[model samples]
Target: MCVAAVSTVQPVLAQTASPAASADKVDQLIKLLDDPEIRALLNKQTAAPAAEADTSMSATEFSALGHRIRDHLRKIGEAIPQVSSEFMRAGGTIADDINGHGPLGVFGLFLTMVLIGLGAEWLFHRIASRSRMHAALAQTDGARQNPLHSAGRHLFAVLAPLVAFSLASLGLFMAMTWPPLLDAIMLPLLLGVIACRFVIRIARLVLIGPRTGKDVAATAGLVPIDRASAVFWYKRIFWFACVFFAGWALVGVMVALSIEPGVRATVGYALGLGMLLVAIETVWNRPAAIARPHGRGAMEWALTFYLCLLWGLWVAGLVIILWLGIYALILPGLLKATTAMARNAFGGTPDVPGSGNPVVEVLVERGARAIIITLAVLWLAFLINKRSSMFTGEAMTDRIIQGVLAGAIILLVADILWQIAKAVINRTLEHAQVSTADSAHAARNGRLLTLLPILRTMLAIVIALIAVMMVLSGLGVQVAPLIAGAGIFGVAIGFGSQTLVKDVISGVFYMMDDAFRVGEYIQSGSYKGTVESFSIRSVKLRHHRGPVFTVPFGTLGAIENMSRDWVIDKFTISVGYDTDINKVRKMVKGVGAALLEDEELGPLIIETLKMKGVEQFGDYGIDLSFAMMTKPGYQTTIRRRAYMMIREAFTQNGVVFASPTVQVAGGDSSSAAAAASTVKTAMDLKKLAESGEGA
Candidate 1:
């Protein structure tokens, strides 16, 4: 609408009473030729429009037609003198006619000036006045900057949108009636005033942020460029406004240049985009100044300016890409450095002795390494971009070359990091000097060994299955069909593997319950040995004599961990039953008393150890059972030491150790005597046989 209206601006420019404005707007030359000097200027620029040629004519025909016309004209005695008059009448020969010199021309020019240009000017002045006035009121006085004043100011600003709404009816009426050039700006303008209330809101959150709203603006360094930002906020608003304005302007230009419209648009857009990119790069990567231009603004202002600049936005995208690239480059090296730094900072790995503050040290090393890698990667990527742009030629070939160069840089950097990581891991392994890995890894290996075969089977199965799925998916099999097939297959598998599943479930519980742990001697399923490995399907044991046995968990229905809880130990002394049993009890009590006072055993023993009494009375000796509660796994050592102490104490008391014995005695009858005795007692023998069921 605007450019179509340019015919309107042209007349307004030509007829303008002000000489200076007309001088600057030379397109108003028809009206401007009212000035005799400008008329001469228009005459010098005059040129004839080309004559129309017939569409059906070929080049030769057209040339022949043109020759025939010239010959006819010559026959009619045609010359420049007569042609000049016709051209003059047609308003091409004379300069005064160029700016439309007729009285009707003057009326048309004046009318257009009033309709569009003058009308737009009037609205411009009107809105500009209102904008200025609104800003003035917002900045009334700096005296009331305290909380109470701030509160009051905020309350008033909140009410301002309502006030603007009331005046909007009048503004809208004027807009509807006059239909000004910028009716589009009115709604956005009103909404913006309401938004100012939000800026004031920042002042209330002083706990975590700055106190003054001006501080935010100061941080943005927007104040010097705009004293009225508190009221106007024009900087942010104008960008949005201009974008719509440019869009409207673009449409107008496209309409005017419609003959070759695509070419025009493509060229304009490419050039515009290129310039924007150049501008963004220039400012975004610019070195920070030694000091602020005037030291009157916060750092945020500089950053915001950089952010808003064209180059800054363009490079900001590059920054993220560069950062990711660098991370891919340097992150592996940094992670390796982190692990090494962890060992150094903590004195060793967490499981190793003297590895102090392992948790904290490990975290700091890893976190710091991650951050450092990230920053280095970003910096390196930026360096590459700058160097490539500067050193490379400006050609399509240059872009490809730069891409190759960047890929090479990333690959080379990543390869170096990989080498370093390998070195670090190797060094760590070397220091341990184990035929196998050290205790930490031994524990891990023990865990993995327990799972390896089962995991190996599971992984192989899963990989094969996934490959099948991939092949199906590659053929464009729908997920629904695959999932449905999986569901059915799972049902079939569940039915087929029921016993195995049951074994796995039971095994998991047994292992988790500490029914048996690896390296602990245990008896389960009539098989007794030290536990070698425990898996979902099976349990493994290395027996005392050196045979390894694998038992399915389903068969391991019962378990007894001899190594768990405490051991009930008994030692015998000959003649102990007759030799003052009460004194013997007191002597064992003394032993228990001494053990209770020991520092290490004191905490481990939940209850005091005691001799329960002589459990068996025999002809030669009495057997005693000593009972004690000991820490799990430590019970074996505790029981051994306690038994040793009992033996030493009993021997000192002259108590001789006793052993169990058996004696054979002669019966009432031997071979012949038994036969005579049985003959006399045949009835008794028969009764005996009957009692034995005829045996």
Candidate 2:
């Protein structure tokens, strides 16, 4: 019985196993083989070949970029009808909202919010009207008073109403419930409106300034641009803001409507073209006073081409290249314009010495620069995030983009710090400028002047090095190794260039010791001159005789500072032996008194010139020692004047300067007379020869 049953089961199984059943068995077997280990093994086997295929495909795509661009353009052209439909649909949505099918439709709700906001803004404006008027009036006298204060007041006055409007509008919008579609569209629109209005108001304040009276000429704007330029820019900027905000709102609406990405890109390109045209128009037709001169039309054409290239890059979705071009073309001009505007607003005339507040000027300038750079960095980050896959090798592109953004931020921060440091150092130097008027703090001022420049240079180098290192780290470089290598290299260099190290070290010590300062006369070995300036390793010495020497600090040993405190000058004057000592002393005293009474020389003299008895007996006569103490650098002049006065006094008082005398004894009178005559003739001949030689 068991044998018969087995035989029957085998036949039945064979009959059931048809082709479809076999195929099902094979699929089950494949599923059983699909384990993680087996899949990983298969991937490993095909990885190299897949990578090669991807590389080839990337190369092909790169080679056919123009074709792709053309195809994209064709797609954009074909989607024009769809784009129009989408825009019409968006308009219809707004229209439907305005038709009041529901309570407080989008349009009515927006209108109510705007009206409330405007009313709030109006109330705020009325409340602050007196302050605003005062700020406006302050503009006329801004240059005479504190310009920063005036600018701040005006800024506050202008911003108050806008703040009130923003708060009211945002509060109302948030408080009301909105449909998802209308919510998305209305929020961006409202925000864009508020932002646009704020931008326009602030731009107007900066460019057109406050206007209290009817005459536009009375406007004292922060920037020194002429009224025509102000008006032109104000109008152009207004239009630009309108277009920008409108495009922003449109993009949001299209996004809410689920428009095709290609159509959206096309619309964006169109808006960009509009912007480009506006820029071109502004560039070409700018006021002559503010416009760059294009005498040969080269600059204008170049600018136009550059702008078009930027647009093309944008169209091609080459975000990196587009941003690089923008930064290259725009950053320097923006920085310069911002700085100039800040200086003109908060500072006095740029060319005038000590005219402006350095702190305020640098703060405003660097703050503006920081804002611009931050905005640019943020925009670039957004572009990278949005178009990360626009380039091949997405990982590398992301890293590069991140590095660039970080580097830009690092540079901006470093620049702000450097500018602030530079401003402080410069201001200190300006205050430390040596004055001709004698003051107790002259030495301290000179020392400050001498050391601050080197400190500033060193500080700049340190900031630059640190910023570069941070940027390298951001770029994914092994900064630890680089830093170690730099340290080693610096050590090697220091060892190799011992003289430079010595000079630098000596200079530092010299500054610390305050041995010599700028404008002080010092003598070291054979080098004697007035300190003109200082460098890291050397001091510039300007000689009294009009030669400049750059002497290494290491070479300057045992410095002799001649222009410190007071200088006592002494000289010997021989007088006739027959002169009365008492009378001569009295005459010298009179001369000293007269010198002290003189207007020009009186202040220079610390102690009047005095005759210090007989210094010694000379062959000609007795040598009287004359000494005077006077301020440094004026001692020589006073000594010269004293010599002249003494000579005049001696001549007037019949006190003759001594001369050589010879007496002939035990000789005939005629012989003696002849001898004297011969001596006199010889002396006269010698004097003539000496005069001739002098000439």
Which candidate has the top score in lDDT?
Answer: 2
lDDT of prediction 1: 0.51
Q: Kindly list the per-residue Cα lDDT of model 2 for residues 619-690, writing each as its tens digit.
A: 789999989999999988898998898899889999989998878987699989898999999899999999
lDDT of 2: 0.84
lDDT of each: 0.51, 0.84
Candidate 1, poorest ten consecutive residues by summed lDDT:
203-212
Question: What lDDT score goes with residue 346 in model 1?
Answer: 36
**What C-alpha lDDT, on a 0 to 100 scale, does residue 274 get in candidate 2?**
83
CA RMSD per model (angstroms)? 25.8, 9.9
Which structure among the candidates has the greatest TM-score?
A: 2
Error of 2 at 61 (Å): 5.9
